[model samples]
Target: MARENKRKAAEKAEEGDEFTGREDKRPRKEKVQPSQIKNKEKRSAVYAKLKHEKQVEKRKKIKARDAAFKQAIELGEEPAQKMVPRTIENTREADETVIRPNDEEFLAGNDADEFSTVLKQQTVPKVLITTCRYNSSRGPAFIKELLSAIPNAHYYKRGTYELKKIVEYANNMEFTSVIVVHTNRREPDALLIIGLPDGPTAHFRLSNLVLRKDIKNHGNPTSHKPELVLNNFTTRLGNRIGRMIQSLFPQDPNFRGRRVVTFHNQRDFIFFRHHRYIFEVKEKKGDPKDKKSKALKEKTPKKVIARLQECGPRFTLKLVSLQHGTFDSKGGEFEWVHKADMDTSRRRFFI
Candidate 1:
């Protein structure tokens, strides 16, 4: 112990004059000075400036487009097309009713053809429309528009009532179908269509909606107010629901004819319309000898009409594809779907 103490004493005595190879066991971090904060602010300022410039450039582009369109109208040239890029799939393709199969396609079998023919002759339907209480403000407007389009549609406000109970109520009331709106973030985002008495339930995403107010057709006002046009996403969904309801119509109509039901959705609100489509002459304006005809006498506007015959029951139908991801699960009645399913070739219906 004495020899060890003497060696330590010798090492301590030589520490001031000689180097010992040893690193500090713990190092202290440098204190952050106020200057570092200023440097960070400087970097962020540069980013902010860049972001502002980009936004200005985008606004300028939009203004230019509007001006160009106005100029074209004055020159009597073709109006400029708005080339706004879409971040998501849109409904332009689904705008037409061509997605529904023709009589020749699915009506090949004698039994199926007979059933369709019966449906065409006698179609009466009763439908129930339910709106999410969270979206009451917009829901009623949509409901009113649909009521005008469809006949014998009942409206209800969905509060704390559960889906099972609602379905039961629909069944007891003798409703052919139930349409439910589901809201998210104060916006109507999804739709649920279920056939009464244990039929498949379809859920769809509703987007790219254009209501009647949004369209400025001052020269031509449609009777359909708060009109809704569903996008491609909803059209594919509607295709499925249409087929299900089509099956429900019996092969033979009663003395009153065939009865059909439909549940359509747009902008997250469910619409009901149950009428057969028919052709009629479109409306005209002014006289056939008007001076406006002198500009282009060679061009004649052919009128077109897409009307409904009010066959049995008047209602609307719109619903779509089964997907795994839109947050759907195997057991739930509403399944989440993917965007790709909108274009699937196997879809039973279109728009």
Candidate 2:
């Protein structure tokens, strides 16, 4: 420690803090702690074990291959041709037959000793997500990142919802997860369903709230009135939303799509994660003339940013809480009402 003191002492003295002990003392060697040495040994042991298992696994695979080859030879099967040219004997009119293996036979082929049954295997769910913005862009980009973290994930353009040809896409693949992204304008509404992660279901409001809730994303349900942009959002989204959500399968909380919320497109809807609804963003579109309406509508863009930003943190808390509640599905869209079915009293708000 004398050398360490000497090294530091000069600098310390220059800096006006006195260094204790002899300036000429020899530097002590750093003590190698036993715990560090043990840790190195443990790491080496783990690596050695992993290497051994890999080698053993490689040997087992080779043995199985050799057994198959020998059995094939014993059964007088044709020898596999090496580097054969496909064009040599191939003809255009040859009928192709595809053979599907029997499930029982396939299961029988797996080594009984090995854990080869498909049941124990965990599958990452395939996800299809859409956002309010039609760009094969931000929403698609987020899905890519999500799929990177998962496996067997799929993504598509939100605009494809508009196409008549999209039925094939909808019918061909089964999505284990479907997500929609929407921006939060205020405390998000009652009807907003945030997906859960484990499977194809979700929670609304607080997962634990144990109450039925219906929401109007762009409209304030409490006020029983629509905000200016929220009303426009409702109308604009109403026509397209059913097509957008039709292909989506819902998932429970912990779903990946709802991971982030963006203010970038609040003027439109953001249906994030796996969901059945869309967000209706409310913004002050123009100068308000009336005192009460102007006071409510005239918040700065900065406040809007805060409201949207709070979406993620609050949603995460709600999801993590797993607030237990049951939702009874209400028929039809919130904005869609047929005059034939509506009571005259209820039609007052319809106009």
Candidate 3:
């Protein structure tokens, strides 16, 4: 060490001699130092980069593992996704974001829960009103009128064009029964499916109709409300009341209709209905047509009248009052259904 210091001092003196324009016989000392802070910083940066790279590799491996498990379950393997420890090599970590051990696995667990819940939830029957054709020369005015009367009714534009929308909407809500409306071929041309949800909701018949549009109007279609058009059936000549019971009301293995025992509608609430037995109709005090209703004043006792002589007791007609109220406040027998649950994973359903 002494020899080295002597040499370093001798080199500095020789530099001073050169400045004075004299010859010097000594070597100049090296100016660079062995312990500069800049060198230390460069070493630190390299170490940090290596650590961060290792951490990134670990996270990517974890992510891939989680995603595979999720896909396996979705493909019917039944096994589900799980998480495991993931390492990070970096010393400094960000505060806002946490690198999950297995993020995709966490999401998979949530998806499984949703699927389980949806499968168990009961599904209600829905009444569907679809026109085989729309945007015809005549407008859909009649359809509009009935929709006004029935709230939450499903309406669809024809074809597979709007089928996806139907499935999506049905997934989000429930239905009671489906009613399909079509044009009548005869003078009274209206097809209606009623009294559904009592059995399999698919059976409906157009055996009874008012008229044939072709026979009466000669293909001249008229724009009118369906209700008004149905009323025009009264002018028909033949009593062709072939409801096709076999086609419309099939034997159901699971359907037992619900009976309504009581109804409560008063001044406090507007959910009121006419209290009546069979063959009677008590018009509400506030309806516009109540003044013109002769049945309300007639007060006919409950009676059973057989429309056809060749019918059994089951086929006999019992004259009954038409119950009223917007929220199904009829005090009699009715059909009830549970809410419909559907799988929303790109599946198709009838609307």
Error of 3 at 72 (Å): 89
Residue 283's lDDT within candidate 1 is: 46
Q: Report lDDT (CA) for all predictions.
A: 0.52, 0.34, 0.34
Give the Å shift of residue 202 in candidate 1.
Answer: 1.2
Q: Across residues 1-351, which tens digit of lDDT does each residue of candidate 3 receive?
A: 999999999888878897888876558787543344367877677667778999999999889878887888789785543544553322223332232445775445434431222223333224455553434332255455334323235676766444334433444554343344444442113333332322222222222221222122222212211111011111011001111111221122111211111112111111211111123344434546546457655664444532211100011111111111111323433322212352232221111
Candidate order by decreasing TM-score: 1, 2, 3
lDDT of 2: 0.34
Q: Evaluated with lDDT, which candidate comes out highest?
A: 1
Please report the TM-score between candidate 3 and the true structure. 0.21
The candidate 3 region of ten consecutive residues with least summed lDDT is 231-240
Reference-based lDDT, residue 98, model 2: 16
Indicate the residue-level lDDT of 132 in model 3.
39
- TM-score of candidate 1 to 2 decimals: 0.40
